[model samples]
Target: MHHTASSHSGPDHGTPRTVAAHRQAFHDLLAAFARPENTEQLPLLAALGRGLAMDILAPLDLPPFANSQMDGYAVRSADIPDAGAELRITDPIPAGAAPAALETGLAAPIMTGAMIPPGADAVVPIELAEPDVFPVPGKAATVRLPPVLAGTFVRDAGSDVRAGELALAAGTCLGPGQLGLLAALGITVVTVYRKARVLLVTTGDEVVEPGSPLAAGKIYDANGTLLEAAMRQAGLDVLRTGISTDSPDELLLLLRRHSPAVDLIVTTGGVSKGAYEVVRQATAAQEVEFLHVAMQPGGPQGLGRFDGTPFIGFPGNPVSCLISFEMFLRPVLGTLLGSPAPRPAVKARLASPLTSPEGKHQVRRGTLLPDGTVRLEGGAGSHLIHALANSNALVHVPVGTSALVAGEEVEVWTL
Candidate 1:
């Protein structure tokens, strides 16, 4: 139970907690305040874009042998039969060297990843032979290939992945084609999954920090540069601190000085119910809770823990702290960072009419339309940060419906 909220007796909160039960109580308070993240290893050029904490296998055979995907001659396809048949070149492999065996009516000039020489089987393209280049080595050449077929350009040996297979599976994400297939399988390092540091904060005494100066009723701190650019675009690491004011002992001494380095505290404008909330009076005595989830711009929120880390909070509107980090911490940090691409939700249509409130869950912002139609861009108002900077899609609506009408469809999400 570590604090739960959303009960407001029987009227306001009793029936408001729905946005899918407060996003499944922030996925069971981040699976009981998460804490597994430690993997590392890295190196494949510092594991570009991270995430894969295991399963990579294939440490060899990804084209680890039968090479030469063309640079001319290799032969043995019944020693070039039809068209012109000249075959006699010999010695010229040049790609990492190691070719010697093609004697029977020789033709080996290779080059283009080289290696396939022991009595070759097929390559033919140095622009289809007939003296198309590489032939000098100690003179006496003869190239004229035309009958190509036995594995035509050749590149086999586990043609991409098979030194025991499963080249990349443990939550893969690396990217540039999985780090160019782990650098063509030589692999150099790679374990990954650590990232999520996150401290962020951002409370408010009327905010104001963006280039300072403002005073009458403050307001500039767009939720600390909008939740530190949405927690560094969801890859986490953040830290921030910045605004904090409505003091609850300076927000519990800034959450006990960044709760020993951070693994998720988030906060953003004291958890609502106004009158200088200060993260609901600095974790009112630890466990947290706050609530009000029916969702709209972002319905108040606030999860648990703080000294034990894992907090959450989020509400002083910058589009309700980026629609509550796109409805509860971007799908639980894309499933605790195993994120191999998650986004999803699409559907479109609604170009105009909207409303929403009978039970909660509204979202809004929109824009999608390139014929797909979504529209909205600012009105349900949660201090409209320029309508979430001219929208890019969120829409949703759900909970016992209240209005919708302009052509209808809906769903959206995609920001």
Candidate 2:
């Protein structure tokens, strides 16, 4: 393939890349920055989305002691074989109360979760025993026991969680189920990895806020809203979000102002080779390196330090901005943020034919049918916002694909 840019040294051989090459390179760069911070203790209820700092070990044995698994008569396993007979009631045991010692020839009334008293070897459920035969008034829960193993109805201590057992491991993202377990263990708080701070900004002279009046050639600021929403939904604590025109001084000033407070700074638009690309001109003198990737829509990618803060610059086009986040930022941040990254392309049959550039990979928005078929939502233009709105997934056609046919299986990345 013909080279598109000047030579530069990289982890890969010094050669021009198809869009896939640049995307992978960008992903590697983000991955290299994936060093998560040490975990912090959060209230048990609020730890749902954080990664566990270390293995969760049970401080005490679950149940702590043997107890009845059901409402039954605690008796000796050496009792008679049949259970439809009455046994003398010696004592009553309720949950959260200590049990009385079993007498040699008498049974004890027991409820579910009631501790089994000493000298009792088995439990006969109320249903398995005969009704009260004792003529005692207002106090009759005695029952006959059916022959069973010594520990048949007993819930042994630590059955749910053994003392010192590892319940959760480090790097584990806490969920509702995990929180329930920790709560059951009586843990009031837990340690989880800290969240990354992010700053999102959008640029362009033609871009305006959503509720503002649009000029003749201006467009609504879709990137800022879309990206900022996506980042917050992904568990990032966004420090600041703003919009600026194509002014190098303004963009530089904003970056410098917010740099110290954020872990990542993401900007959309103004990174390409165009003359008015303010972000490129302003950040070039700093540590950020701008490169034209081989991918469609999101071809221009930038990485560098914005006032000593890590920055990711994406293409100005709406779709390109979103795709760059999914392909690069989302995956890395998901890992550090302790959230699941969006799923990648699943194989789906093509519903129609399409042509793609020979040297660059194409990511097209499409609607995936239940029958495992995929149809391009709109034409291959990057400006097709309505098409993107209707699409449920993005089809990833690799670099070498020049033409595709109906019924061909392709990779589809769900949005």
Candidate number achieving the greatest TM-score relative to the actual structure: 2
How many pairs of residues collide in model 2?
Answer: 4
What tens digits encode model 2's per-residue C-alpha lDDT throughout 23-108?
A: 55555554533444445779987877766766788998887888999887888777645443456787578798887788776788
lDDT of 1 by residue, 1-415 (tens): 3563433222235545777667777777766323445777878877676678777788688788898886877888886667658777877888988877887888877788878988788888887667677867889878777787888889988887779879888766677888888888777888777777878878777877888799888768877777787777666678786777787898798789878887778877777776778787777777777767777877777777777676888877788888888777777656655643566688988988888986777888878978998889868889878878888878888888999889989889777
Relative to the true structure, candidate 1 reaches a TM of 0.37
Could you report the Cα RMSD, in angstroms, for every candidate shown?
Answer: 16.3, 5.3
All candidates: TM-score: 0.37, 0.76
Clashes of 1: 3
- Candidate 2 local lDDT, residue 98: 89
